[model samples]
Target: MGEAARYDVVQISDFRLPGGTTSSIAEEVRAQSEAGLSTALMHAAGSVTGYPIPWSTHIRRILDLPGVHVATPRDRLHATVLVIRHPTVIWSTPSTFDHVTADHVVIVVNHAAIDGAGTRHYDVEATDRRVRSLFGLDPIWAPIGPVVRGTVLQQTTEVPLRDEDWVNIFQMPEGAAERETFIGKKPVIGRHSRPQPGKWPDTKEDILAAYPNSPGYDVQILGGAKIARRKIGWIPDRWTVIPFGGEEPFDFLRRIDFWVYMHHPDLREAFGRAAMEALAAGCVAILPPYMKALFGDAALYAEPHEVLALVDEHWSSPEAFLAQSRRAQEFARSFSPQMHLRRLQELGVAVPETGATRQDEPAVAGTDAQAGASAGPQPTFVLNLDPQDLGLARELTRGLSATGSPVVMGLVADGAEKDPLGPDEIRLPGPPAFHLVEETGAGTWRRYITQRLRRLLADVGARRVVTVGTTIPEPVMEAFDGQAVEHHWVRPDDGSPLDVQLAVRMNAVSAIAADAAPETLAVTILKESTL
Candidate 1:
């Protein structure tokens, strides 16, 4: 037979394994590996030195999945560089896209859509633009279903049922066996999620009060120490509070007759993985009405106050509860790992039997050049320098100028009438072009600067612009108006001074000028400094 086809598929994310709630990203990686793909997981959270003293069992399960190569870079910047260098397809979460540049096809799994509350709202459209600006390509959006489905499939297969003696021959947890053996006697009600104040409903206390203090019913609040602590005094006589981890959460899920989720209605659920898990375990869920699109007929919708009444209605009628529970299980089955893999295939992610190109191959050069040529003249590097960043700005200008790229050095005056740069501060090996702006309040200055920068970029016929500073002012970004521009922040490493940061920025710019593809837009360099 011919040599096995070589290809690389990698998943990059902030959290590698399950922590409080199971990471759907990790589950997707596991699913890919099971489908005979050579997969690697680059943990963007960086390195873990020693074995975690108290690790979650769910995390351990993920670590043990077959054929998964895990890597932890020294920092996120290094991880981005590594991701760019290898792989035919790069899969990432929206939050993990900082400083990451993907020359290859990128598939973004959007787990959360709406961010911020009330007037400070940001939706998927803003996220899409940010990703496009960073990577220079619109990413294909994938749902979180496959990962959730995979979890349900694994749990259903791994956990033996009470009716199946042959399956129970394998050693199992006592709680798992107990869960399978115990049918509905007294109504068991619970909710599982990462404990965070924003996730709780405003009517949480009122919802809890609806559950009677009777012996016939049981209540469990799973996940998060803060939840346990806050509800300690308020917990009813038959209620138990369990922190997230081990087999207990899963056991509790198995025992739950009604899964009550009281997340604020204004907040988007982003696929609701925890709720899906509960549904898969045959727990009839009572969630907010806005989630109808996400859950379809799989869940029962109720407002916070209506939750207790809904639970009572279901508890009083076993047939009504069982019917909804069966619908939930059926809906959960649709999200299986196989379906996820199929979706990835549909989106042009290739599954090769053999490894592909070496990591050092020039991935971005040709594309960058073509994109630059089509846009306008050769690119210009602009540094919006504050007083402290002047030295670094000067160094970057010299570096980019050496590569035959035009450079503009701009000063951010601190609302002073005179120029921020004095004769002593103006020292440079070669004279470089410069611009000056007087900084004012956020509203006025942002508009003025953006307009000035836009004119400057247009006048220079700049095909691509790289902005270097402490931070790229939001106005500068808005000025680009979704044009091709990159942001490079001058940040020193721990214990390093301005000179060290200058060196790092110079090196990163040189690399981009040398290797960046024409299609490249924005890139942020250097790890964030603490001090």
Candidate 2:
């Protein structure tokens, strides 16, 4: 907001990524705007999982809306209501919200819950504790659905979580309202999620029992079948497989008669957005037993082995299927766009009588500080993190991030002299905030310096590299040279300014391999892979 405009609602979220949380937040902003509320939005710098949150088209459109302005860090903005979409931002970068007024109603919404805490997958209990501990603010804890709410309280950890039921803000897609019952001999059943193991059943048998590979059934899968390939060792030849983003979710949901979803035991789903959307689109959802608390009467819940029985029960009677489909749609509609407005109104927030107008088009994502910065490739800086050189590494990394160049700092073990005794050791001891990546696999000293470094650099899409503190070893340089990438070194003691010195060569680089976040998700994805 140019002149420090006050907002009725301010939402802070991972608008940096495309998925359930961002999509819901975008819709939330739209709903607020439509209800005559002035809304502002901000994106968290750190995501829960250190995943790549790209600047995609969908993200751009939401930020470009008429009433939805970026809540710039520079502005001392006030809000009647302040929303933190997930615990990720507030817990990681609490200072981002410092500009907003403290008098507003603060709501922290938890979208996902991990049972065990770690660096990547955040702990639910730990986050709840941290939010209460860090800010004197006793924020209303709003979990996305019953799953999240239940998951939080079920935890043995004692955190006074003022848990409130806040189902996801969702509705049927543009043309998904008029769906008829299936009457064919062969039925099509499917599931759409980010093809991860945690999103599927624990065992192949459990998976196959629910999502049958039998000849009589036609199975359609969106969000990739890589999990299927990894779990089953081969995707069933009978199934139709499409990667995530390959097709629209509603289109895939429409093609299927049933939405069958059963995840691993450890996965506290938090909320099933895809299934909710399917229900909105009039697909009969066959969910697990626990989901009954959230979806109630809308979706049939049974163990994986019992899913087909439920599917068959309705299949035998088209009228019954149609009736259940109607119930599903009816239930999903209860969480309509207006529900968001209703929730805010309950808290005594003033909402406008007239609706805000919507315009079509998208603008780039950024705050006031990033106003002039273009969204192109990110810049890679390899700081030599040897014990003696960490001071320079920290200074160099700090400056690179200031340039808004999507910095990727490498924390390599080969260069460090301290910890090599442990065969399977991983050292990520950090200079906080800056992400220092390194090659992960264990290897010999020779292989560590050459192949490992080359692989790590390639993953980050570093075609032109700048080494700070210590120059890359000759062997590593030679390996990169063969890959058609430029590796340049600068002495750490050089008095040159970081941003100014690199600007010219950085502009001149071929830009052939533009930097993007490394999708080093194969191993993790496989680890979570269930059928």
Candidate 3:
């Protein structure tokens, strides 16, 4: 045989074990390795672990896998710089990209809300920019579920059942054995989630109060620290608080009859993996109205006040409970690892036919004119600025105006007051475009601004856009997607007026060259930097 095709795939994310929990992105990496892809998992930041757990131990544990390789760079910044030079596919988990540039990047979003709390937290504009910066293309977003394998649950042994406890019913694969067939005398209600403020509803105390010290029912709170911190006025005998780490989530979930998640409506879960895992373990899930789209009939919807009543209704009727449990189990199967792999393939992600070694190629370097010539015909350039940076924008505009390149200035109107200019006013050679993005209570105005900036760039036929600001916002950096366009970020404190002008001009030229010869541009920049 000649040479085997390389199956190199790198996953960059916040991965930890033992004291900390692993994200769904890490799980996807594991699945990819099992499918015959040569996979490497790198920590987005430094080695993540609980106290007393050394980084070497974590690495050793992860490397034990047959085809999985693990690497923890000095820090996130180092990893970001390293991946840009690597000649292999790089996958970044949610919201890790900073100022670093990459050619082939696949970003996976695990949650709906990105920046902060509430439904509007989905910073559509920033997400779009992030996709563009990583992929060098426009994004077409679609909701894709995570790949949760059965193996995540297999690590922990099963907890023995009690005669007084009612087992949660679930549907198995075709022709699989029917393990559970009876309902117990007492109901064992449970809640499994990170014990965070957002995950709990405002009426948490009321729900806990419902499970009083009685023979009919008992409550168990799994996942999180001791319940003493909650200070919910309930007797010690009423409920059991199982802190994380003693047993795996599935082990605790398997023992519970119902899996209730009473998260606040404001907090959005991109895809509730824990709830899905509960479903896989045959626990009938109780979710809020917001989760309807994700879980469908797989879970029972209940308001905060109706939680106790809903549980009572299910407890009274065994047939109805079993049907819902079976539905949830079936729905959970849809998020299988195999299904995720196929979805990735459908999205045009390359999979190597045969495993082989990675090719280490040095980047090519060239001058601005040569790079521009190779990039094809010269195109228009725009200088974008936040309203606060209007002074620098003016200086850069005046200096670059002499270069004879068709340059325009654009202003982003954030909610904050502008020192010199009003909302609609900013002086420039050509009519300055004002993008008014008012901040609503939803906290997503940055996204709106990013969207407007993208539209402005496209409208002006901007081949290269230079942003002059104190510090470029991550969202704004992301908006400069598309192979036809190049984005350069210039800080106000970089140098004197002449320095800024020269830098802008050079960057403009560099952008033109970058469009034509990315490899040459990378080599040139790498040579200049210590990295």
TM-score to true structure, per model: 0.50, 0.63, 0.50
- Model 1 per-residue lDDT tens digits across residues 388-419: 54555556555655555544444443322223
Instruction: Point to the candidate with the largest TM-score.
Output: 2
Off by over 4 Å in 1: 1-7, 16-22, 46-60, 72-104, 107-116, 119-136, 143-184, 209-216, 228-233, 246-248, 351-531
* Steric clash count of candidate 2: 1
Candidate number achieving the greatest lDDT relative to the actual structure: 2
Give lDDT tens digits, candidate 2, residues 211-317: 78899888888888787677777888888889898998887787889888877766666677877888988988998787788888998898989988988888888
How far is each candidate from the true structure, as Cα RMSD in Å? 18.8, 15.7, 19.3
lDDT of each: 0.47, 0.59, 0.46
Better candidate by lDDT, 1 or 3? 1
| Candidate 3 stretches greater than 4 Å from native | 1-8, 16-21, 46-62, 71-104, 114-124, 127-179, 209-213, 225-236, 349-531
